[model samples]
Target: MSLIHVNDDNFASMVQKGGVTMAEFGAPWCPPCKVLLPILEELSAELGDSVPILTVDVDESPVSAGRFGVMAMPTVIVFHDGEPVEKLVGLRSKAAYAAVLAKAAALSPESPAAAR
Candidate 1:
């Protein structure tokens, strides 16, 4: 799956749907944010429907960004069961993000492994 672009209007609904959701709060002009975009896309493809990857432009969706207290560009928040579980600020390695998503998926009751 590709990264979903969320604005203030649909951010809550999109995130709270269920399972593990990774939302990147960033801006188009930010260097680090640009750098992280491809990484997120790669993860989105790798994880497929198992994890939902979202992107929010801070400049366009200030409400959502401020609600999450995202003070830095490229703040990636991992949410499980509609609640914030892990927050990573700044640019990070793909493995770091993958690890967090794997942990979140394992913790989610909706996940198959969690059911088992």
Candidate 2:
């Protein structure tokens, strides 16, 4: 699956949807964010349709960034049922992201992963 691009217009609705939503908040120029992209992509692939992974450019979507209190680039947030359950900053390993996804899935009542 591909990463969904989120903006101020759709950010609220995207994360507010039931189940697990992973939102990566960063800018194009951020080096750490750039490094994190492929890792998240890999994690998304591993998770398949169990979780939705989203990317939001802080430069283009300041409203959503500010709302989430994103003080730095490469902020990854795992939202469960519209509430943020995990927040990570900087570049992290794919394993770390997988752990977060696992937590999100376990917490989401709508996730089929929870049945596994």
Candidate 3:
């Protein structure tokens, strides 16, 4: 599956859905956020429908960030179903993101949206 961009309108449904969702909380002004987009896309393509990669722009959706208690930009929060499974804050490498995704993939009981 392709990446899902989360906003105020879709936040509830995105979080409540089944399967693995890796939500990236980012701000357009942040340089690291720009660097991470392609990496996210690659990961999303690699994972396919088994896991869905979701991105939430902090500048676009402050409410979502506040709800997630995100104090910083570029926060990567992974969820299984309606619950959180893993979180990574600040700038990180593609390997790091993959490592977290791998953990989420292994830990999640059901197949990820990307794998589907």
Candidate 4:
């Protein structure tokens, strides 16, 4: 799993990097965030080198989370080439989130990944 931990400092690059990215906006104390952790891990592992999955601790870097307009814990946002294209709040199944990723991947300009 390619999980990059982001704080106030590294959020810009994390969001603006190439390819599709699924970034989880969460707080350490949020139970739903804890629940979604494993699903993100499995997603990162399964997606291999194609898409990147990252975690943002809102408690530490509220700026990034706020910039993305993440108003709640366990919010998932998909960014493609630095622009957000989709968002989901609360806990969601892997398949549901995967569909979001698939759509983001397909929508990215010049991205070669096939939409599933």
TM-score of each: 0.92, 0.91, 0.87, 0.90
Please report the candidate that would top lDDT against the real structure: 1
Off by over 4 Å in 1: 109-116
The clash number for model 4 is: 0
Q: What is the lDDT of residue 60 in candidate 1?
A: 94
Error of 3 at 65 (Å): 0.3
Q: Which ten residues in a row have the lowest lDDT in candidate 2?
A: 107-116
Positional deviation of 49 in candidate 3, in angstroms?
A: 1.5
Model 3 C-alpha lDDT per residue in residues 90-109, reported as the tens digit of each score: 88898998887777666655
Which is superior by TM-score, 2 or 4? 2
Rank by TM-score, descending? 1, 2, 4, 3
Task: Give candidates' CA RMSD values in order.
Answer: 2.1, 1.6, 2.4, 1.7
lDDT of each: 0.88, 0.86, 0.81, 0.84
Q: Given candidate 3, what's the lDDT at residue 76?
A: 92
Error of 3 at 17 (Å): 3.5
Per-model clash counts, in order, read 0, 0, 12, 0
By TM-score, the better pick of 1 and 2 is: 1
Best by TM-score: 1
Worst 10 residues of 4 by lDDT: 107-116
